[model samples]
Target: MSLRLFNPRVISRAALPSTSRTFIPSIRRLQDSSSDAPANPKLESIVDQIASLNLVEAADLAQLLKTKLNIQDVAMPAVAAAPAASADAAAEAEEDKPKEKTIFSVKLESIDQTAKAKVIKEVKALNPTMNLVEAKKFVESAPQVLKEGLTKEDAEKLQKALEAAGAKIVLE
Candidate 1:
């Protein structure tokens, strides 16, 4: 057994069957099949054109094509039902989410006598279209609404601006 393990005759290369015949035929078949298939230049050009477009441009092109073709969006029945089921679950989870204040009102309660000029300047800065004289009158009128139906961010910004100018302000 030790001699057999060391002998070259135990596993000879000649004993193996040739795989070149089977392997070469499959490769040749693939080449031949590919050569028989026709190349589409129109499709290739369209694909190349689409690939060159940025994401926004591609989306705009898709929208334009959809509109021009008058194609209505068709969703698969299974796909449509899946989102509806998930949306119900999502709606239930949303109930636990904190609601954010969307709309706000910024009211000017009053202005410090010493900072009246500064408050008027700040108000004018806030509304660039309003002249200095109009801004002075707007500031002099106590307990007046500076801006109404503002977004939360806009209201907070206005509140900070008024407070910095030594004016009493409230956001509702």
Candidate 2:
């Protein structure tokens, strides 16, 4: 290998090669040179100074170097963590349940005088404002209401109508 002498103090005027393979051609030339080049005094002094420092001094120096040499400290924007539930969600849940019927299932025998107590019992079970004739009418209608079966909803409506109609001749 032929040796090419280069002045160490002078910076090269040519642009450094862009590729990784050619990044340090000057270093490669020194390696190929026959004459020994003195180790860089500045680099040697810096390395020796770092090695000599105590732990606290080394940490402070490192922090200073980082502050001076750092290129970027950009922060990325954060995304919303969770989507909120809408007001319509509660209404949707309520709509899913089966609506209770307003009818009642009652037996026919409760209308008879002997079974009057049972009629009163069933009437008060659904509504406390029930009186004798209203109870009787409700009991008498039991056959028709129970013909195909009645929901609690229908029974409640009939009971209200009977109560509103007031006292009447249940047997006659």
Cα lDDT tens digits for candidate 1, 1-172: 3553446446554554578546666888789868857658898799999999999999999899999999888775555648988788889889889888788889999999999999999999988999999999998887888888899888998899889989999987
Winning model by lDDT: 1
Worst 10 residues of 2 by lDDT: 163-172
Q: Model 2: residues >4 Å from true position, as ranges?
A: 1-27, 30-37, 71-172
Alpha-carbon RMSD, each predicted model:
20.8, 22.8
How well is each residue in 1-109 modelled by candidate 2, as lDDT tens digits?
9997777446453533467336577677867664676667999898899999999999898788778998455686543443234335656777997776553453342
Residue 154 error, candidate 1, Å: 2.0
TM-score of every model? 0.42, 0.24
Q: What value of lDDT does candidate 2 attain over all alpha carbons? A: 0.56
Consecutive 10-residue window with the lowest summed lDDT within model 1: 1-10
Clashing pairs in model 2, backbone N/Cα/C closer than 3 A: 101-153, 102-152, 102-153, 102-154, 103-151, 103-152, 103-153, 103-154, 103-155, 104-155
Cα error of candidate 1 at position 61, Å: 53
- Misplaced by over 4 Å in model 1 are 1-100
